[model samples]
Target: MSRKRLLPALALLAFVAGCGANAAADDSAKLSLDAPLPTAVPDGAKIVVGDPATEVALKLSGQYDKVSKYVQFANLSGGPQTTEAFRAHALDLGSVAEIPPIHATWTGLHVKIVASKFRQDPLNHPIYKLGVAPGVSVKTFGDLRGKKIAYSPGQAQGALILKVLKKAGLTKDDVKLVELPSTGDVYAQALAGKQVDVAPIGGVQIKRYLAKYGKDGASTIDHGLRDDAGHLYGPVESLEDPAKAAAIRAYVAAWGVAQEWIDKHPKEWIEGYYVKNQGLSAADGQWLVDNAGHPDIPADWSDAIQRQQETIELLAQETGNKVIEAKDLYDLRFQTVAADAIKGGAK
Candidate 1:
């Protein structure tokens, strides 16, 4: 071969090798959970969130426009639907209790919690109370020993039932666990029809259950456990994307601000969220407001993580599932993002 021809061929090979190295680098560029989160949402970055309550809160609080540029809210919530959405890659964020993330991990879906909220006075404003079926005599947790308690294994309500049983010193063998879906008014309906002797019910269900079945001796009693665990979580893949991560950080900040707005302006929240959006009566809305206490967003998630660890242990024991470290379920890089945003009034 001629020297000139050989030199050009060698140069072309060198250029191809360089291009291959750059492509490899790009392919390996995964986000580190320990690294600091990105600070800006790149142009055209978008996140699909399945958190209807937050969507309404943001709009009513007038903070929707601030995040609407990069955020799209979907009418989705709860563990099952959110997990399904995550599996289909249709949802970037979801609002759920502490259970969904744990269950998702068990089912082989990697996820992380970006924001956490609890009731200010969690005991006084417990998320659910034990609804006793008509003609069932369950005045205390001890009474639950022989009663058929409604249970939903993957949801928060199911975990709460387990916590209650542990508190009562009763094992699953001691009580009849009627596995039921706790969506909508199923628990309430179970109580009304006497299908289950006891089930955990929250919000307006507590008031309506008694009003309709008081004559038949239906009642609700405080379970005396702290069950107010609210969180915004997302798939690890979504959080690893630089643009989506930045957008999530911003949405979390806006979410924290919207929580504060709802706490401060109960009337408007009741009207906009409960009465108008949820199709509940004004009295029902007011009742929810009266019962909701206040929002407590913590800058530090150590205590929350520890509590989650305990829950994981309990669930593992009951369901015979592998126990996981709660810390791994959280992305500590976002530990203080929402709290700082609320304090700084960013939205």
Candidate 2:
């Protein structure tokens, strides 16, 4: 019954090392350091993590050194819960969708996006579908008018739905919005169970639903709705602390190492996490490998930061809210430090 416990499995990092950014090794010889750089994650530093992917990377790569001892691995359901945990000071570093930090800023929560992942392929993108229950008559965005649509404010579904509506020349006033918890697969389940006429559901959940229900059961809108990027964010208080900030830099660097490792060992990742932990069939796991690629650490934040700003501005406009500047939402210091770490680690 809790809002935070929605899709418990999503936090499992089923497709962990297989989405966004590919790190490749050159033919150059590997460098061996006699001693780790001082910027390496400090010994036994406490950090909180809500993302299973980040947790997997940090642990599997053994990149964070002894800092894992201080980590509290929280199985937060989604961005909304992760944002709440960040606001409550429950976690030092967390990952959430693009909208949560904007909402956090609006609500006076001090948070900043430190790292991000982006995918260029449409299928690779975490595309959310506008689906209707089996018996429902809705087909396109136009049919959504006057219909009861699932709504989870401040989450990706809610934000993306607004964008879809704008493209269709419709607004919330044109549709009956049914508010729901912003965590988990409940929204997808709602549409599948016919509890709502139309809802935003992730592609993976839809794939699973079709695997269970027939292809005709849960119908998806063919509209080209997609999200290309997700963010790893942290509390501003922690980011500003000299020690914690340094630790975060090291964490992002270590993450790059982990991502590089996954890129080279796709089979191990699919067999280990997807098939073993998530129970996906080998074929399905391979499907993920082919679609959801490995994430890369952004070497620079200028362009990505601008894109995040544009997204926030669009969301604000679609929801009839005042526009917010990207400058207010992000801190780019980690980008520089992470670049240094990734370079040093790669060498």
Of candidate 1, the 10-residue stretch with the lowest lDDT total is 16-25
lDDT of 2 by residue, 1-347 (tens): 26445334333332231211011112132212221223644554555667676566555555545446445566763566666665455566777776878887877776777777666554445566677777777776788788888888888778877777877889889988889874457877787777788887774676675566546666776557556667777766665444455566666666566666666778887787678777778887777766666555567777777867777878777666668888667665555655565567642
Model 2 spans > 4 angstroms off: 1-44, 62-72, 137-139, 215-217, 294-297, 318-321, 336-347
Candidate 2 matches the true fold with a TM-score of 0.79
* Least accurate 10 contiguous residues by lDDT in model 2: 18-27
CA lDDT for candidate 1: 0.86
Error of 1 at 124 (Å): 0.7
Clashing pairs counted in every model: 0, 7
Local accuracy of candidate 1 as per-residue lDDT tens digits, 325-344: 99999998889988998899
lDDT agreement of model 2 with the native: 0.65
Best by TM-score: 1
